[model samples]
Target chain A: MAALSPGNQGVRLAVRYLVLILIALIFIFPLLFMLMNSLKPTEQLLADTSSLRAFLPVGDLSLDNYVDAFKRAPVGTFVFNSVLVTGVTVIASLFICSLAAFSFVFLDWVGRGILLSIILATLIIPFETIAIPLLLIVSKLPWFGLNGLEIGWLNTYRVQIIPWIADGLTIFLFVQYFKDLPSELVEAARVEGASWWQVYRRVIMPLSGPVLATGAILKFLVMYNQYLWPLIVVQEESYRPVMVGLGYFFQLNVAWGEVMAYLSLITLPVLAFYLALQRAFIASIASTGVKG
Target chain B: MARVSLKGVRKSFGTADVIKGVDIEIEDGEFVVFVGPSGCGKSTLLRMIAGLEDITDGTLEIGGRVVNDVAPKDRGIAMVFQTYAIFPHMTVRENVAFGLTIKGVPKAEKAEKVAAAARILQMEHLLDRRPSQLSGGQRQRVAIGRAIVRDPAVFLFDEPLSNLDAALRMDMRLEIGKLHQQLGATMIYVTHDQVEAMTLADKIVVLKDGKVMQAGSPMDLYHHPANLFVAGFLGAPSMNFISVDTRSVDNGLAMVANAALDPIEVATTGRDIRTGSRAILGVRPQYLVPSATPAEGMLHGKVTLTERLGAETVVEVGLNDGSRVIAAFGEDRILAPGTEIGLAFDPRQAHLFAEGDRP
Candidate 1:
């Protein structure tokens, strides 16, 4: 801090450091306020709501906000619902996308050019265009899907997962990932007399973990953040995921403070999942090397 | 281990025909090299025989049975690709065992076969390494080991050494020649390098534009090339072709005049030639000599460029009529640029092609 005139320079340096500290505090202050308020008694929280002067409400830094959050909006059930639905969908998307990618990249199936074109065409078709019809179809009975046979999507897990599977984004990710894989590897497997499944299972799958994890993580984030679709069909509060239930929870309880607690709860898992999957994504992109 | 035959086989990618009616008969345990310039369908023909490509027409037989519709795995053939198509994900051991494993061979036999093939290819120390971890030569060795473990009736190699450095290429070339002899398996090797074709093959199948130009012993093709393409394709610093009028010499030998020289008597018993017919005289650089005395085979030309290959020097000479010719010399021989080199040819080794065709 010492420079020119020691006293004045020290004062100037302190001011510069204070400005940087103030900027940092401005960003972190709101989160600190929320966390502290979440711990405060309602009476004190409302009295000085703008300040961050409160300590833990209970002697042992009370977990009352968490307990209240679970009771008020079915947090446990909502989280479980999210993990199950999104987890299964991620797994299924990875499987289906990997299979499609395997087929597109390696096998000499006829009309692959046309098939690839159709799949690529899906990429530009936004999910919003299909959302209403998809929800309507999911709300109703299914029919003539294959060989004129009837299928149903009414209030079923299919209502969420099927539409998500048909999402072009996932397939595009897989196809792009698979397209760069070495064709020589597949040719080698073929020369070794491996059936297509063996090639996909033994070679492609083991090698595709990074992209698969990335694709799965992406799907999980989308399905986790999803509110509109779940809001329309998931009438059962227990069946509702955290995002949709967060909306309904606000309308019913009006617990702004507790919802912040809920927001914190919902937000951390998504961040953790993203962090976990990001490593895989980075690894996948690295190993794929350069793509033509 | 067995004979292979490709009869009237044709392949067309859409309307553009790549292989136009090729027929090649490979005898039991013979190493046949397919040599051609790029886009000449040599690799495509090898792929056809390997069952990697559809025949489109006619039949491919391996071990004496048609394999037109047979699966590549079931075709009694194994192929080593130019890229050394070893599975990057698998260790050398696994790559070698993959064929046996796919055939549902017992784990014990798979291990035994893989080990034996590894030993044969001298890749036992690298059994645990993936293809990416190995050098280009090692990867190619593993690829050949993979083929060997199959104990296939025929082995197909598609430019397997094109990726290696020159030193490694020479090493692998000798290794492959030894492999052919040791395995006693019918091998159809495709390479654009005629030296590989000459050194490794019992019979060399020269191809061009999807058709077989000629198939014969390398020496036979060298001494008596069937056509211009065969003569041009068979050698490095390739054979030189100088056009000349053919005339019957005294002792019933057809002598081709070197314009500058008196005459070169070519040894051929044929009397079917019509007089005054034009022919292209073909002679290799190694056979051309810088004559000591002015006489019979002396063809004078000025040296244009000289390339020394340690043991030998190759001199490209421009003739008086502006046509160029090449002469190969031992290191002791010296020629400077613009110096007139009195070149002579061995008449016995001299060849004549009628107009566009070599007889």
Candidate 2:
């Protein structure tokens, strides 16, 4: 094969960047429209929906919608609830799921293969099929909290956080990552007098940064975007999450400007979580490709 | 240092038997090597001794105590793996001190031991670097340092140098030899490389198909291989096997003859051999010397190929009976293809195996 000339290389490079820029614009257009129209009045917001001006912020704008968005509903409590549940679930899932994965990959026990197969088989079953039964189970479960021995777990942070702690996807991610690690490290650790717990905490977890970041990002998205489960379980205003709280903007006469403001507000936590873990997530993807 | 013994040790995974019943005795302060081809249960036997694999039958003793059910840590053995198995997240100092840390040793004592091991391996300057920051040879040294810090009763090595390049493998082999001398610990090393086994071990155990073929000093096994398998497995350019028929068995020697040569007396230990039974004669390539004339040589053949390797020349000769034999010469010889050549060897340096005798 012949090498490309300098002029041809320049043309190819420019074309590549042009294609990438077009893709970038396609993804960013919706976010641009949301941010721009959030600053306009409801009349201008609805009128400009069919034109490019809706994404340009050229119409009359003010801080009225932002102020009204907070006053109309308990937006602060909703964002807080979502962040709290998502953060706790992400942390606990990384711990419990990684432990389960560790047991599956390293330790030998009876029925291990069958049990792993059963757990992975859960991935094919959509949550919609089991949501009703899951809601019934969590509603009657007892909790020992500040008001010791609570009879039911409805309208509580634990209700959202505990059930999502050990799921099939997170555990599967950890198992695949753990399987790629060299088994010799575990044997060497054992021969060096390390207990099983020490191997998990010191040796395995330290090497699991990329997988942890990946699992955290995935679980955060799933839990923060939760709507159906929280809608059925938590009817109290104080326990409502961001997705269910979006319903408040859809009353008899919807406020388009205030709705955009609520969406823009709720999208902040997910964006921040992803940006913080972007490097590790990319590293995990690149390494997985290389290993495969 | 401690003595290690295996009494009828065997291993099975499901219905397939990996390691058949075998026995071996290793003395204190001795460097023993288990050398064999792939899938010969060498690594499995080493793991069984380290308590990494469970024994299916029989007993294993370390320091005069049966430790079949003991955990790897409690058995007082440290193993160096083929992959080095150094923790990529930890520095060399931390890796070396891991065992001591698990034991809850005092900080000063742990530091002292780590320093001593680093000094022994000559890696004190690399103590602060992670495994990813070091080369393959350096990572292997860190692994050895980790083992040294434990100061265990025995050291186990599972093909530790197989992952290194040729030059690095030579350098590490010498370093391991020096370490064994410096520490004077009982060690069991496993490798398929016979050069390593011949050079580094005080005793060499050869295995084939999960059974012990022979176990003795390196020179003893080389000179007196019990069967045809050991004869071919031990030497490079291996021993040349030629089929022959025994004419008569007198005293301790057998007179053998083949179509390519006259009757020659070869040494054997079998006492139940018949007078006219088939046998094999084993002779090393180095023992075959060139003769001036075919009439005066014990064997006569035509040179088929020659490999001139600077200091020595190896020649492959085809016998009249449609068989081939290799001969290595000390000095370079100009024996081209299709050249007629004659070779001779001493009877004492040759081995004879009867049709079905075990040694």
Which tens-of-lDDT digit does each residue in B56-138 have in candidate 2?
99999999999999999999999999999999899999999999998999999999999999999999999999888999999
Chain A TM-score of candidate 2 vs. true chain A: 0.97
TM-score for candidate 1, residues paired by index: 0.88
lDDT of each: 0.80, 0.92
The segments of candidate 2 whose C-alpha lies over 4 angstroms from its true place after superposition are B294-297, B357-359
lDDT of 1 by residue, B167-262 (tens): 999999999999887888889899999889999999999988999999999999987788888988888789998877677644556666656556
Interface RMSD of each: 1.3, 0.5
lDDT of model 1, residue B171:
100
RMSD of 1: 5.9
In model 1 chain B, where is the ten-residue run with the lowest total lDDT? B267-276
Which DockQ-derived CAPRI band holds candidate 2?
high
> Cα miss at A268, model 2 (Å)?
0.5
The candidate 1 chain A region of ten consecutive residues with least summed lDDT is A52-61
